[model samples]
Target: SYKPNIAFYEAHGLKGWQALEKTIAYLNEKCPDHFTIADAKRGDIGNTSSRYAKAFFEELNFDSITVAPYMGKDSIEPFLEYENKHTILLALTSNVGAFDYQTKMIGDQMLYQKVIDISKEWKNSRNLMYVIGATKAEYLADVRKIIPDSFLLVPGVGAQGGSLEKVCEFGMNDQVGLLVNSSRGILYASNGRDFAEAAAKKARELHVQMKKILINY
Candidate 1:
């Protein structure tokens, strides 16, 4: 799977977006079976969200796009309208600031849990997934209780000091419902001429670890 956070490309302006376009095209050509996610974290009003949906799912041809669910169901339903495309809603993020709101208690559950419960009631929710930070691996057990079958896009591994082993141990469902990401760990594996090779090596390490976990499961 390939997840390209749009912010990285946008930082370089037009050239960056072009590079992003090329990257997506290359992935489509070389790994068509792989799922592609545009980690854009977009969400807006109904009309605006529809355009965002069209831009990512139609124009960009991403299999999924990350969205902020703070705007409520109307902002998210537009993305859910697309067939075979997914809307990855932010729940508990890896960043330190997330605790400001995400983990706050509301009645018997945390705010993030309430967000998940509410989002499940939105239309076409079967196409919905959640972004649960790998940094909070212990929280996965409680998260699974709310949505056991949903896939989780987990970031914060490697560079963020998240444990892949702990994430797999608590987050995996019958279908292995986890996508543990290690962006900086793989991307900046080396600064020399053999950068690509170094990145591949890093990826292989994670692959081997995942394989062992899967085998045990």
Candidate 2:
């Protein structure tokens, strides 16, 4: 299985990030079969992004990292350089604030559609993926026009109220290129020490749902 990108942990904080690392290690040890992601949403100028890439892909040993693309192609190129690793770029976000920019029409197409088109030019971008908010199911068909093959990390399922059936309906691909994330809905399922068990249970529910979704493809 693939990993859930950065927003999942950042919403927590420093302590939560630490918990994320420990969780990654535990999962890597116990469920080595599944891929791990550092949803860091990090991207800076020059060598800054390089170090961010190293911390997540090297030091933390995450299989992938989420990066912002607004700074320019160079800011994202370094993260894309990581071998066999994924770089999930923020395309269309799930929040209401997304209307502040993502939905703005630019001569017939949304701004995010242009970003997706331009990203195809970056180095080693074949490993590049996009962050598509699950709430915007209607936009998935349009997004598919730009990046039909690349994977998409979709958030806003349970707690955010994005429907699973709707996201899969528009986002599923031949390679099953959709990673639907549910963090608070999964992690904080309980306040007890059995939180990890609860998280696993939540993950299992999503996995079961994913299995059914995949069968349709």
Candidate 3:
């Protein structure tokens, strides 16, 4: 969260995304223990997405990434080719506009549910995961039922009005398969050089909260 995940930089422009690569490299070198993610919501034709996979996994060497699943299974398979690296497919997103398509009822199931169901069909699907936004807290149980063992990269905790407790209640598994991210809340905690330290403090706070939650279970 402290490090603007790749998509934040990508949102700026191509140069910004390149800068994001450099930033991940610097973070890996400077803070070896930190987790780095390329938040690129990429999912396209096979060859195209494969190239995107090469860029992120081989060239940039990000630990994880966010991907879109609109293009279907073929668009996602190439990303899973990279061993140990993770591909987080967008399911339920934090944005208000997510309701435009995700919530539309379909045969008594939401559209996002169908995405999760289809996503389970890909090779190495265990390495693949879903971005189940904390905003749609109520749907966590349904998503969990579809893929109980798969990891979920959750966002919208702090600034987006998502409840940590509720998400954990419905989604937590034996291995704690949830990464609840708080980007803006942690990053913009301060604007000065102390920003990093402030961000770390916020992360620590969330960590404490997470620890307590884990303890209860």
By lDDT, the best candidate is: 1
TM-score of 3: 0.90
lDDT of 1 at 211: 92
What is the C-alpha lDDT profile of model 1 across 1-217, one tens digit per residue?
8999899999999999899889888988899999999999999999999999998898889999999989999999999999899899999999898899999999999999999999999999999999999999999999999999999999999888999999998999999999889999999999999999999999999999989999999
| Candidates sorted by TM-score, best first | 1, 3, 2
Q: Relative to the true structure, how large is the alpha-carbon lDDT of every model?
A: 0.95, 0.84, 0.85
Candidate 2 minimal-lDDT segment of 10 residues: 1-10
The clash number for model 3 is: 0
- Name the runs in model 1 displaced over 4 angstroms: none
Error of 1 at 149 (Å): 0.7
Model 3 misplaced stretches (Cα beyond 4 Å):
1-3, 7-18, 31-33
- TM-score for predicted model 2 compared with the true structure: 0.87
TM-score of each: 0.98, 0.87, 0.90
lDDT (tens digit, per residue) of candidate 3 on 1-217: 3225665676789888778767877877898777667877888999999999998888987777789988899999999988988888999999998999988888978999988888888898877888999988888999988989988888999878899999999999899988888888887889999999998899899899989999999
| lDDT against true structure, model 1 | 0.95
Give the clash total for candidate 2: 3
Better candidate by lDDT, 1 or 3: 1
For residues 121-189, could you state the per-residue lDDT of candidate 2 as single tens digits? 999989898999988888999998888888999988977889899998898888778888887778678
